[model samples]
Structure formats: structure tokens, C-alpha cells
Target: MHIQSCGTAIDVNFKDVGSDRDELLQATKKILQKQLVGQSYRLIILQHILPDTVTFLRMARNAGINVAKVFAKPNSIHKPSLETLVDEGFAVSCLDYGEMEGTEVLDKAILQEHALAVQYQEQLVCVDVGGYFCEPLRRLSPKKLPNFKGVVEVTTFGHNRYSAKVKYLAHPVISLAKSPLKNAEALIVGESATLATDLILRENGYLFVGSKVGVLGFGAIGHSTAKALRSKGHLVTVFDTDPIKRVAAKLEGFGVSSSKQDLLGNCDFVFSATATRAVEVADLKHFQNGLVLVSVGSKANEFDIDGLVDAAETAAIDSDGISCLTYAGGTKLKVLRMGKAVNFHVQSCPDEVMDLVFAETVACMATLSTDLPKSVLSELSDESRKEIAAKWLQRGTYERN
Candidate 1:
């Protein structure tokens, strides 16, 4: 196979190297090497600090890409992976998701990239999660730094951010979040999150089966989680701000709540998968006693933990480190995993499942070198994603057979 990008022609090949995790990653690396060859952009990657991410970064470097800087969400930083990244000479930083309502951490990274661009005379590219780089990239002063090539946004939340700023951007923005390939990954992530919640509840001496579960948001993750919970013999109710989603849930045979208050008032447990502040401090009053709140999204902002802490008359931590917030009149709610994504409390997904998205992400980097429409949010071509999927299916089927 041959792919031409950045005015350079490169030969590409995909061969079965076995179907194990390492083998698949090696194959992915070979594909990236051919696609990204002859590119000289300084890449800034923002993703979870995981073993798989370590493999991806190492492969990018091996494929002749300059990985200038790496950043991770504060809660998603895995110690072993952090150590590995640092040991391998990758400049890394953890972004603060604190009380401040600004993009200071991301701003720092942007400044660093600007400096590197001046020093190295290379165009800049960013791979962002959750739209952290959206504003920073848009805010770039062309006079000071005109070498920004583009960005690849990986999450729906981030894609939303980029879309809002599309009119103001000066560089191309490629979104994988809206791709059909990512919808497949979202379903697997949803299942993993539900299983993780079940395991945590069981570990804490609670029976998940008997509890009435509610899912906030009817997006892909939320929809899949509701189905997974129902399959586990739990009655599932869902609430979404969108009427279409509510109707879809009702049609799917799941109870639909008309309002957030009704859902919180009724369910024994709730999964906040909206990727926004689904539960606020004012809404805290609606929570029934003994309600367990589980966050399934990437960030802790799914529920306003700070607001809950301030509103609580008293807070207590159990032996398992679960925090119980007690409001007036004896209403208590327990937050699991300290309001972070519970699925990542261990691993987010099996390596094989994550490999599909990771492969697509690497392939998308090659698009940065191509002439894409500037200042707009676009998806990688269907043909490109199909090609990656076909390769994945071939290796997976071969392994299984």
C-alpha cells in the first residue's frame, strides 16, 4: 500500500503479525510509520496516562514523529505510565481540573509549544481530549506563531468546544468523536463502566441487582450503560435533557424520567454519563438518602463534588474511602471513586477493544499533513476509517479462527 501526504509518497503494508495485544500494536506502529513518514511537525498529545498510550507515543517516535510534549487529565494519570513517559524523555505535565474556571494549564502547554515551534522551526499539531486545546489553539496569535498545522480532537465534549469556536479558528480541526468508528468504542466503554460499577458495589457489600438504577444522559455511552444494567437484572430508568433521547429510551422499553429531580428522587443508584455537571449543589436536595452516585465520563465534572462538599453539613469517609455527604434532614449520598470515572479506577477497556480507536487516532495524525479545510470541524474520511477497520477485522478474525 502507498499513501501520499505532505507531498511525500510512502509505501504502506499490513501483514498478520499474530493477534495478541503486542502484535496488534506492532502492526499499528508499522501502519503509522508509513503514513507519517516525511512529516516534521511537533506533536502535543493530551490523553490518559495508560500503558497503551505509552505504547502509542513510543510508536509515534519510532515512526519518525517528534512528540514534543504530553499532558494528561489530573485524575487519569497512572503512576507507572507517568514514570515511563518521563524516563523515556517525553516532557509531560498534569493539567489542573481545580476550582478555577479557566484553561491555565492548557495555556501553559500552548505557550510551550509556541516556544518549541520558534526554536525548532516546525509546524505544531495537537491531539486533544475533551477540547482542552480548543480555546488555546483558537487564541493563538498568527503574528507570533503561524506554524500551527492543526488539531485532532478525540472526545464528543472536546468536539463540541471546537465546533463552537470553528468560526474563530485558523487551522484545520479533525474530530474522531463524531466518527462511526468511535460510536463502536463508546458502546464498549459503556459496558466496561457498568461492569466496573457493579464490581465496586459488590466489593462494598452492596447488591447492585436489587437497586433501582438511573442513567443521566441518553447519549451513546448512557444508552449502552442503561442496556447493560438492564441485562444484569436491574430495573433501569433514564433521563436526558433532549426530548428525542427521552423518547428513544421510552421506546427502548426503559422507564424515562421527565426531569432530573424525578430520576434522582426515585433511583437508588445513578450513573452520571452526561459529560457535564448533571448533578448540581442546588439539585442535591432532590437526592434520596443512600443514593450512590457513579461517574462514567472521563472527568469528575459530571457531578459538582465541590458544590456538594460545600453544601453538606458534615462529610465522612468510610473504610473504603468512599465519601458520604450528609445534608440537613439526614439525606446522605455516597460518591464512588471520588467522583472520577470508575472504569478507569482500574483499566478503562481491554487492550484489544481500545486498539481500534488508537489505530484510528494514529491514522488521523497523517491527515494533518494533508490540505484540509481550515477553521472547521471535520471527520476523517469514511474510506480511511474503513481501511483501518478492515485491517483490524482481518487480524481479529485470523486470531479467533
Candidate 2:
């Protein structure tokens, strides 16, 4: 089969590596690979280097897909897995979150990908984590970058970014951020974040039990985290800018804060799951003494770390992995994982849970390889998700039996 785009056609001849139903990732790979057997495309993925991600990449390669480049987030790169990718002959690059802004890193990557596409005459498909490719790709002329096919965005944050640029997009985007598969993963992520926070606090000689905890967002992760914390004996209050989410929290029996200030003032520890800058530098004044800030999302943008550092009289990391920022007025704020995702500091999502997301991502890639509407946003069909879920269930049952 030949998938034609931009006056170029690539022949796809993927042979079915028979189903390995006992292993989840392998089983998922087999099921999803059926969609790509008659399609071909090169992939450039921007993702964290977690164990599941490493497994996903190997699965993609085994399915006869050419993984051109993988841009690993610096904050979430697992060293051993990264070395494995290097040794396996996968072209890998790590993004520097400190020296370069997220979009800047994405822009540079897109440019390099454009060059590769032009030179190799292969259609390019970008798998984005944080919507980093949306704006930069929107600005590019289609005539100059013809080999670019589309993107598969996998985060709610990234989906929002692409949604904003939907009208101006120059290529198709398959969003799995808000898909049911991702929603399932978010539940596990939320539970993992809560556990990691507790473990980190204990390691730092702080008891989170009986503490007043506040969740800064009432999204899926926030809601799950709040419930998990409350179950573990923490007083959990929830806050959100969205009135609907605030109402949802209230209806769900969580103590809803009237304002961010109220939540900040009342809670001993605040978990920012807003995916954006939930707490800014100016909000530091409302911070009470000995308040700990935890970022539940992947990026450091959850809390303004640079602003906090600049405003602090002294910033230092103790023997524990926590960073303490002492303000001039004597308020000390402790940050876990230096404002990166705490769940990542521990194990990310469990391997089985993340396999669902990875499988969905691969399915999205297969969908992108087909001829689709251009310069618009799309999603994996319900039929596709159901198919993946069915395979997952089959694998799980087989493992148990």
C-alpha cells in the first residue's frame, strides 16, 4: 500500500509479527500494527523517557515504522532507558528545559525535522506531548514544508494548545489528550502523584498526614489527587478558575475554596495540577509559613520556579530532594522535585496503566498514516479505541489466568 501526500508516496509492507497476548505491550503492538500494515510514515516523538516509552519505541520499530528522532524531555529522562535507546541506534536528543523555553525547543526540532523530510523524501508525523509543535508548525508555509503529514498530541495541555490553533493549522492533528484512554491513565496518574508526594514528604522528614492539603485545579488529575489525599487522612480543599469544575468539586463532596488565596492561606501543602502556572511569583505574598508546593503536572510551569528563586532571600536544597525558598518576610516554601512532576520522580504511571495510553498513541499514529483531512483537528474513532481496549482486556485476562 502507498500513502500519498505532498506528491510523495511511501510503500508500506508490514508483516504481522504474531500476537504475543501474554505480554501487554507486545499484544497492544500487534493489535495496533494491523492499522499500519498498508501505511508508511516516519515519526518524530516528543516524550518522556520512561520505561513504557522505551517499550513503545521498540514496539514501533518492530512494527516496521521508522522512528526518525525522539526528543526526550530533560526533566523526565530515565538515564538507563536513554542509554538503551542510544545503543539501539535510535537518533535521540534531549530537550533542555532550563536553557531553552518549551516552544523554542520545539521550533528547533521542527526545523531539523523539515530538513530530514526534505532530504529523505519521507512524510513526517510528529507525536507531541505538550502541544509544542502547534504554533511553530502553524507558522510554516505548506509549500516549503510539503512532506510534513500531521501530529498526534497526547496531553490535555497539548490538546488545548492545538485547539487554539485549529483554524490556522497547516496540517492535520490527531488529539488523544482528552480521549477515554487518556482519561483512564489520568486516574492512575493522580493516584501515583498522591503516593509520590507522601513518599517524598516522608523522605524529607515531613509528615503529610493530618495536614490541610489544597488542590489548585479540579481537573481529572486534581480531582483524583484530592480524593486520594483525603482518603489518606489529609484535609483536602479544591480550587479552580473554572466555575463548572468548582461546582463539580463541590458536588463531589470536596471542600471547595472560594478563591486561590483562600486555598493558599488555609492549606499546609498545595498541589498545582493546573498544567499552567497555577501559582505565580506575586502570589508568594499569600503563602503562609512552611507551605509546601507540589507540581502534579510534567512541566515546571506549574509553579513559577524562576520567579520564586528570584524573589527568595535564600534558595537551597537540603539533604533531601526538596528545595526550600526562604522569603524576606520569613515564609519558607518547600518545592518537591524542584517543581517538576512528582509522579515522575517516583515511578510514573504503572506499566499496565501507561500501556493503554501508549497503545492508543500507536493507534493514532496509524490513523495519521492514512489519507485524512488536512489543516484541521481530529481524533481517533470510538471504534479504534474500543478495539484497543478490547485487546487490553484480553491481555489482562490472559495474564491473570
Candidate 3:
């Protein structure tokens, strides 16, 4: 409770008046300062935003990362989308990774842990609403690696600890209980919850109820995406590497499959969220034309975009005199952003549902703690507004040194 030099206090109030989002954000700041050992922590986080990184930072703190005294750069990972926050001097000041090597505060072990975790699993899905792994090595505490041992999974029934990172997922709940027809038509498959949900919604609009759909990867987001598809009257087909999970989906009234070619060739929509880098890349040749290929993996290597780029017309948006898309036919694809990245919470204008979920999740995870210094979860409630605010500002004060 008495974390020192960790900046501000961190505590979220999901229910109350006069208690706003600033309290949540502050909570996050304090925890990160404590866990990552700011004085020596050197890490570089690259992202459009820092919410997910922030979330994981909080989770690390809960696992025992001493954020305040040990890790350096209290605000390195706290690069706020808000121009005001950036201007207010809360952003992580940039440093030369070339210069800050061989220091005791800087831990080569940090990268070693991530490398080990990545090596531990065939595939790893690193999720962050706020920070990146690099920040720990480059700016925070270089003296140590993240406290991987503190990371654990605690459900309502029990708890389980994992050596790998992805095992500490974001969440696992979805609502597909809209109507009886939702159950009648069910099929689920996609690489990520966002993409699976998007494609399944489209599939339900086109396919009739009771249509068998196959879902690959039933992780936290995957399950929700599949459930949403199931609600729209398409049958969800479950296929995954996890035995317990694969069987669970089967028990939940879904057909399970093991072969990628066999499953995609047959299902109306092959939504995949398997949490791997190249999910269906090499094996994508098996998918037939008009197969409605879509990817939602956080890392865009899930599908062979190079192959699909020639098959469709793309939409164009000129950014600073740069053409962002290419129009082919009716398929609104981005030749520039070929990867079908859809923010489920912010799919449309003025939508922050995902951001809210992201902030809440991080807040809860940060309170938990880690061995290495880690940050606490703070509410970035106004991330959308902050994003817009940043649009008007030029590049951050950081000019490569």
C-alpha cells in the first residue's frame, strides 16, 4: 500500500460520484513507478497508444514488480494520447538505446525473459493498452527483467500460474444471448475477437440460422467474438490447440475441427483468432476463392496479405499527400493498411467502449503487482478524446538523438 517514489496514488472507483477517471490514471502511474524500478529500467514501447501496455503494467505490479525505487523512467510507458498530458510533461522522455548499455540499472535480463516467454510458447499474443517491453530495458530499470513468475491466472473457480506471457490474457466473457434465433444460427471462426466478431456479423447477415461456423482459438477475445456470432443465428465451430478449451466449446454446442484446409473450405465463415503470428499464412493456399478471408490478429502476420492484395480493390485515404488506400471493386480494403484491423470498441465515431474495458482491465491488473518494478493500472478514460487532441499536435517532443 505504501509504494515510494511511484509518482501518484493508484485506485479505480467503478461505482461512485465525484470520483472520475483521473483517479484511475493516477493509480496506474504509481504502480508502474514501483514495479519496473524506474531508476534503472530501460525499455522502448512502440504503439499508436499505450493502453494495453498500461494494463499489463498494472498486472505486473500485482505480480510484484517494484515500480517506484527500482525501475527508472516513471512515465516512459505513460505516453498519453492527450496533447495536454504530453505537454504536461508526463510522456516518457526518449533516450539513446545505443548509449545506455552495460549499466547495472538496465537489465539485459528483461529482454531475456520476454525472449524466453516467447520461446516458451509456439505463439505469443502480447496485449497492452499502455506500454511496451522495450521501455523496461531502454529507459526504466535495465538491471532486471520483468518478474515473469508473478504472472498468474486466477478465475472464480481457482488459480493457475504460467511461465509464458499470453497465458495472462485480458478477459474471457462475451454476450451472445440476444434471441432464440441467435442460438439457431451459429458458426464462429476468426483470428482475433475483433475480426471474428466483424466477419461473423457479416456472415449472420448473409447466412441463415443453424449454419455451422468454425472458430479457431477460443481465448478471452476469441470466445466473445464466437459467442457474438452464435447469437446472430450462425452455428459456431470451435477449433483450437488447447484440449480443455476445444472440448469445452464442443460441449457448448459447437462442432470442433483440427485441419485448417478442411475447416475453412467447409465453413461459411472461417473466423480465426488462434493467437499466433502466421496463423493461416503458409496453409492459406487451401482456402477457395470468395472464401471471405479476413484477419483480426493484433500482429498482422496472421494471413498472407501479399496474396490477397491482388484479389481485391482497396479504399484510399490521402494522409499528408499520401494515398492510404486503393479502390478495386466493392471490397473496401486498405492497400496501405491491408491488415483488417478493426477496433471493436471504437469501430465507429465517438465509441470508447473498448477503451473503457481496456482501462478497467489494466486498473485491476496493475493492483496485483510483480517482482520487477511495475506500474499500477490507471483509467485512461479520455483516450479517444486524447487521440483526437493529438491529431492537431505535431510529433511528440522526442526527436531521435
Residues 1-401 of candidate 2 have per-residue lDDT tens digits of: 01111111111121211233226574566665687675556788988776567778878888777798887765676665666677688887764654234456666666777787778666678998888787777777777767777888888788888888788987789988678877777787788788888887787787777889999998878877888888888888999999999999989888999999988888899998887778889898788789999888666679888888899999996422689989987889998878877877566576677777888887877776665744488888899899888887776433533
Give TM-scores for every candidate, taking all chains together and pairing residue i with residue i: 0.88, 0.88, 0.45
How far in Å is the alpha carbon of 102 misplaced in model 3? 20
As for candidate 1, its clashing pairs are: 131-158
Superposed on all Cα atoms, the candidates' RMSDs to the truth, in angstroms, are 7.9, 7.7, 15.1
TM-score, structure 3 vs. true: 0.45
List candidate 2 stretches off by more than 4 Å: 1-22, 98-121, 318-320, 371-375, 396-401
Comparing 2 and 3 by lDDT, which wins? 2
lDDT of 2 at 325: 86
Summing lDDT over every window of 10 consecutive residues in candidate 1, give the lowest-scoring window: 1-10
For all candidates in order, the CA lDDT equals 0.74, 0.76, 0.36
Give the per-residue lDDT digits (tens) of candidate 1, residues 1-401: 01111111111121212223365464476558667767777888888776777777877787777898887666666665666677788887664654112846666666777688768777677888887776676777656667776788888778877888888876678888868777776787788787777777777787677669999999978988888888888899999999999999999999999899999999999998887778988887788888989888677778888788888899875422368888888899999876877766556665566667777777777776666544367888888888877777766432533
For model 1, what is the C-alpha lDDT against the true structure? 0.74
**Worst ten in a row by lDDT for model 2:** 1-10
lDDT of 3 by residue, 1-401 (tens): 12233222112111221113223333333333443342222122222223433433334344443222112222222223222223333333232223232343223433443455445431111222112232332243312323332221111111111113223323221111221112111111122233333444453354334655666667654576677667777777777778898888888777777766667666655565554543434444455433443344333334556555544355243211112223243423221123433222121111122232333333223323222223221222244224322331322232222
Shift in Å, residue 4, candidate 2: 41
Predicted model with the maximum lDDT: 2
